[model samples]
Target chain A: MTQTPVTDSAVNPQVAAAPVAVDVPMMRLHVKILRFNPETDKKAHWVTYDMEAQPGDRMVDVLNEIKWYKETGLAFRRSCQHGICGSDAMLINGRNRLACKTLVRDVAKDGGTVTVEPIRGLKVEKDLLVDMEPFFDAYRAIMPYFIHPTPFPAKEQYQSEANAEKMAHSSNCILCACCTTSCPIFWVNGSYIGPAALVQAHRFIFDTRDEAKQQRLGVVNQNTGVWRCRTAYNCTEACPRGIPITQLIEEVKREVMFGQS
Target chain B: MYKGREGQWAFLLHRISGLAILVYLLLHVFSIGSMIFGEPFYMKIHNTYDFVLFRLGLVAVVAAVVYHAFNGLRIILMDFTSIGVSVQRQAWYGVLGITALATLYALIKLIPRIAGGY
Candidate 1:
């Protein structure tokens, strides 16, 4: 990657000249990955793979090296190879993060070890692959799509900037389940609908054009809904999209309590 | 990874302090309620609590109660206020600061009493 050095003689005549294109030095990183094969192995185990990685190499690149060069049997879920797909969310060093987005330098401690595991609170199917059905089920339960039950007008339903701004961050969620899987509450109670579902509900609940605010709010207002969130803020921290999930859930809680819709 | 910051610790400490208060409450009721069994029983119960370990436990309980009470208010503020969620970490430090001050105050008042054995 081409990077302008912080100190360059071009900018400051007194300073020594620095290279315009500075290549990131490669460092050896020991990746300890949680491995599980439901058919062969009754339990999960850790397998460490030592490899050289550039500072800016993504976690997915590290996993790809293990799967392609070291061990051909290594398995993982990755599609877009970018953060947008949200298919590669995993537990990186104890936090839920998109594997494709997290750089090796940021996660690796002084060129030491980086632990990779399937996101918790879900069934592991194989190495680095967790069953995402439960995560998606919660997402589906929130009625994620826009719903306007009544007949629509002839023209487009234009939304105001203020109204759109309210649901802007919530809509950015890619259903990654990073927030939901990282939640301690969801780790034990799988039916709590989790933060992903709540964010989805928030997106619809706050939309000015959607008529299903009460319907959507009612779904999230159950005993296992917004009230279950203990304001741990783990969801807020675990969100790969940087969505303020805990605040959204709290807003939903207030709506449920006061019937604000 | 599990490197949770101030918010995580705040939640964990809040839960722990709340449970500590509950345990202390149960012990308090049982010990104080020993008065029903007459003077000898009440005296025995009170004397046992005077032990150094038990005295230390009482101080810890005071700290717990203070932390729990202040953190509970922080949680309530986070639930209702517009700026509370944004500035939650600062509010948590405030909660911890108040708890520390209250615990220090308790220590100042109780140390002399414990030392004098009165």
Candidate 2:
């Protein structure tokens, strides 16, 4: 493998003027990727690969490299290479992280093993791909959209900045299921409304513009609803968007406990 | 491997221990209620707590109470104060340590009593 200085982005020409005149250093990263096939394998197995890489490559890029040169059977989900898409969220090392966002260098700047696996609590359809229907089911149950009690105004209705800021952080959620799937509560009990759905519920619930507050509250207060959450904080740590998910759940719970007082 | 976070384990223990304690409380209340009969009849009741296994169960109940109470305090402090989420793991370790020490002291005091008599 060639370790040519990866000037993939040559915008900063000043970089080329550095006359150190040395071969680009090589990094060997041992990637232990979990593999499973429903048709054949009875259980999942770890497939570790020792490969050369640039320090700047993201974990997704490493997967791509493996798929490009080594294994054709590897599978995962990604669309936007940026963090916004939230498709490539997986258990990196131990915690959930978007493969597209986690730089390999950040994982191991000195080059070491990085384990990759599908997020827990979801059925793995193939390799890294998991059935997202369960996650979406919870999302759909929350009616993840704006609601209005009255007829539409002819013009836009204004909302105060403070009111808008209440739903601000939760509104940034990408529905990646990272926060929800990482939760131990949701992991063991699929009936529980997971963090992502609650976050989505929270997004519309606190919206001053939305008129379905009571309906939303009723839905989340069910037996398999927000009450199941134990404030574990896993969702907050796992969110790629860095939303304070446990706090949002708490806010909704508070609203439920003492309505509009 | 799924290496669980500290909060997850603590929450699990809190729930399990809470359930066990509830069971113990209900049974104790039932036994006390059974004392409404005559004194001789009440004295004829089984000495369940006199057994070694019963003593062990009591120790477990004591341990659970210690852990749940201390962890509850840790959680309360975090809620009321500006304590950041970063120290959560350390806080868990500290509370667990205190729980262990307290449980050990309770066992030391209770063991001799059980050995002596009913």
Candidate 3:
């Protein structure tokens, strides 16, 4: 390697100097995103962007690149960007994953076309964004908050450590629509309470302190509730928190079927 | 939901296979009802099943049944068992691989019987 001495002009580029030799090859990726804007467009369409990215760059960073440097019209949601907020969940390379959690190199195909789209079963709000009202409606139907007949104790309510551990996986949910949106049953039958809501139901139903176990079981006893789950395991696979969503849904289904008291 | 190709394919195969089995069961019971009429009527109805086209249909149905059964086991493992939940993608591949080989073996055996050896 030949050394070109750094001139005073190179140190302070206002003076200008000879261009430095370059060797690193630029890596590029094509992010194919589904775009829709009800205000201006009749239907959704595919839009591709050519982006230069590093191996470690996250999918949200790729969208940020398009918004910040390439195209300003790109739209998606992000909060903590650390998978905690679960706002950036989307379909990347044919699976639901957090945009901030998915790395650029991981999703890039061997031939190099990475498809990005809003999670299914929801109305598209815009590019890479989906209306989350339907998902939240199912979640809210599950009565995610704790419910008990008796009033609170003078101090903290007595919940055993063993009992808390039973609801550990269900408690990890951050309201990400990945599991629910990845469900085929939910896509065909929008009325079906999907896996995410079922998991939420399980969260409360299994809590020893909860007095509404019977109520939660009744909520999921219908045809379009936990019975709709065919155990495809797509929800289990799509969950970012590694929660056993299918297992939780199955527990609810068993409770519904056998009338567990 | 259908975005993931492998999972979507498995789910579709499961549903289609299930419907196929149910419809076949109805047809099977109805056709066997010919036995109540007499021996000739029963043999006449059963003879069509010996044809090449029906043999091919048999192979397809068997494939469907095998795929559905194995995939159901895979899903049961995923849903009921604690450990298999995490490696579901790999379990999916296992279901597919086993179904393919088992279906092939079934076809190979059925092709021989189609020629009237059995």
Candidate 4:
């Protein structure tokens, strides 16, 4: 191999012009939040914050980043980081979704702003946390606990696989109240016992082990009970666990209307 | 009863009011259906509704109608489009609150008429 001598200007050239630095785009997120102070403000207001966000970041992550790193007064509820706990359900942009499950990139897809607010209908405790008592009240009113018929046998109470499959969907309720909150019927009347309770009631109504079907049906037969559901299908649409809430409610309505098993 | 967060309650109330309206409508239809039996039977049934219990039922039905109709419009907006769900709580509160005030005014005006002031 032969080596050739190179010129200084050709070899150096100001160290190749400082290696022409290439700029990589950093992730940026703009969150416009609805803020209200029950103690100080007479009305709610919109507040926007700029955030540094990554592609995998969930809405809950952005909210925490804003609270811990930017604003200390931000308020919202989140129990389990995973979607199972159902504690972080909120309005992201405009739809009802669990904050922990929503990706910030998807929410800001249009290069537009992202908006966060408390779930609708309940009283706001602060910025993002709203009172959740009414939801549970409706849940409890349906007598959700299982009421077994006759004494338990020495062996495990058996259900055919088909029967078990029949009740499987309604049994998946996490008591998240997401379905109940999304229901339009529940939105108009607080006393309607809502879909969650109706779904719970249906769980036991179809159970061969449960003997209190009539009693349970009677509770829901009131002026503000299963009869209220219009089958809007919003509950089914909003359910994170994919529970068929409207189907169960319709079944319960049938049982109540017909007074059958 | 669980307080069920704010949005949950609004949703619950919407369902309740909707059901109330439905029940009231059924009763109204049944009551009016008696007209097919001729005016005498209809008049008899209509006259029975002059009692205080019936009047109270009317008031409830009216309130339910007002709430359901107003809240229903709100729900229609929320469900049919993308704009209303974010402010759903506010829209619900706004509709029901205004409807309640209007219902109160209507009741105040109606009571005098029903009480034989006319």
Candidate 5:
């Protein structure tokens, strides 16, 4: 690679002439988003916006462009712009994904048309934000915490590598609601505890030290529990964290059917 | 639809086939149960089933039953074993292949009946 020597004018603060960099390619994207305001609109509708965006931009970036300069009234949630916060999950191009994780180049076509919608099986509160209380309520019902009959060790409870490995895969759940909302069963029956809850339950249920395994099993063994999973595998495909949700749910189902070995 | 993959298609076909089998079962029960009323009534229903279209529909019902039975076993394997879960997508294709072959075999056997209108 050849380096160009910088002139004094380029480095001087008071310089009037300096070369500007505009070599980056920007593609025009047509974003169609679902819009609804309870206080204003009587029903939900879709609105499209055409704007210039980089092909490498994330879906969240395009939404940011629309919210920042195009339409300020747009409502959505995003705390950590990355995928870890478990927020900003939405239906992007007919699949559940984190806006922060999905890139424009992946979903956009030659014409650059992308459709965004709120995750299903929940009340859409605004344009992209849905009521998360029901999702959280299900997670709570699963008792997504460690419990042991004996008192804690003075330093820390010992867990073998093998024991930790059993629950390690299920521990990746960020509670993003991606898996739960993508479920076809949950779409029809809201009472179903859903995949996210099962993932959470699996996280603790498999723990060797958790004494509440039986109680937790009783909670998920209900009619609205693991049995509702029709094995559509949509949750597995939609999961941004790539957790084997269907497999874990199957394990939980087995545990419920024949007592854990 | 969220553009689900093979598992989604499998679940969908399973549901459809199960329903198709149920419909066939109900029709079969009603037609066969007519024997209690009289031989003529039973014969009349049986004769109606001999129509070319009904015979062709029977082939579809058989296909549905075959697909449902095999897919039910696949689902059972998936529920009980990790190997089944790993190979579910492949097993789905296998189920389709088996259903197609079974349907073809049924069609070949029934071709004489369907053509002769017996």
Candidate 6:
């Protein structure tokens, strides 16, 4: 057998140790979620879940993973998986945001936990889904659908460039209800027409094709309508679509006050 | 007139009465500034106070001012901290109760003075 010479340095007791080959497992995310079931329970509870999330994983992905692999009873509302759907809005770390657009890595960047709760100012139906009937009711009460004058063909209504530009900004409402849910006025007075409905009313009031501007203005002129807004600008901040809700509401108030529309 | 929603009704009433009080304040300031002209102008305007309608107008202005002041304080408190939002309904009721009592006291005192019996 051939003898292999071992170096004295390799066998030395005081030699600097080679870098520790410790296999550190990737960090896991601890999501503290609020859960409620009014049909069966009297109070809400917090449920925790450990999710292994990658750098680019979104909140929707983590939720879907939990729903599919961990707990079949977990429930949430999601659609389109894009920012346009506005269905996945929930409170992430005490702020309302669309779950489909929030990156998990950014939220859990410091290797800390994240908390998810249902949007405030609405009745919670399940884990993360809120009953949006009140929100949509306010939207419909404002007459969101277009109402143009009669005696016109089925073709597109002719609108000048200036007219189109006037109504363009208010036309970006996606009916997300995020702004409505985030508004303090709506939380206090459910009868208040809210920012979403007021913005919708402004949309029609500014549109050149709409001939019922006066009637719409009359509808919003009631005590619970545009007057209820205190211009706190919370709705504008909570809007994920970046719609200028406060500006539109202010313009509508100006028009109503001056009787210009 | 709104029955079921007392809090909302109170808010609307507060705003309406606040605006009324503001308008009345502006008019009162303008009328009082007429004193700069001399006692003749002051007496001319002050003599109108002896009439019944003018007395009633004084009462209305007083009531509106009292209610608006109390409600404005409540709103200011609401803006100062989140504590007011949590107890907003209670705070509103407190303002309403205080305003009603103050208005009643003022009316009692004013009616006697107007009748020249105080």
Best candidate, lDDT: 5
Q: Return the lDDT, model 5, position A99.
A: 97
i-RMS for every candidate: 1.7, 3.2, 3.2, 9.3, 0.7, 11.0
For model 6, how does the per-residue alpha-carbon lDDT over A108-179 read when each residue is reduced to its tens digit? 864679888888788888888888998888888878877865888779768899999887877887777877
Better of 4 and 5 by TM-score: 5
Q: Is candidate 1 or candidate 2 better by lDDT?
A: 1
Candidate 6 ranges with C-alpha deviation above 4 Å: A1-27, A153-156, B1-118
Instruction: Looking at model 6, give its docking quality level.
Output: incorrect
State residue A257's C-alpha deviation in candidate 5, in Å. 2.3
Quote the TM-score that chain A achieves in each candidate. 0.89, 0.90, 0.87, 0.85, 0.89, 0.85
Chain B TM-score of candidate 3 stands at: 0.83
| DockQ, model 5, C-alpha based | 0.76
Supply candidate 2's per-residue lDDT for A129: 96
Best by DockQ: 5
| Predicted candidate 6 versus true structure: per-residue lDDT over B1-118, tens digit per residue | 1111334555677768978878877878877998999989887877766787767666677777777787777666554444554465677788778877877787887886667621
Scored against the true structure, residue B42 in model 2 reaches a CA lDDT of 58
DockQ-based class of model 4? incorrect
DockQ of 6: 0.04
Q: What fraction of native interface contacts does model 4 preserve?
A: 0.00
What TM-scores do the predictions have? 0.90, 0.81, 0.80, 0.62, 0.91, 0.62
Q: Which candidate, 2 or 6, would have the higher TM-score against the true structure?
A: 2
Between the candidate structures 1 and 3, which one is better when assessed by TM-score?
1
Model 2: per-residue lDDT, tens digit, A67-145? 7557877889988879888889899988899998888877775568988999999999998999999999999999998
Docking band of candidate 1? acceptable
User: What CAPRI grade goes to candidate 3?
Assistant: acceptable
Candidate lDDT (C-alpha), each: 0.84, 0.80, 0.81, 0.73, 0.88, 0.74
lDDT of 1 by residue, A1-261 (tens): 113245433555553432332456667889999999888998899999888777787899778767755787998989998888899999999899999999988988545999999998998899888899988888888888878779999999999999999999999999888988888778889888899999999999888898888888888888888878888898899888889998888887887778755
RMSD of each: 7.8, 5.6, 6.6, 15.1, 5.7, 16.5
| B1-118: candidate 5 lDDT, tens digit per residue | 7888999899989998898889889998999899999999999999998777897997898899999999999999999998999999999999999999999999999888778877
Candidate 4 overall lDDT versus native: 0.73
Error of 1 at A110 (Å): 5.5
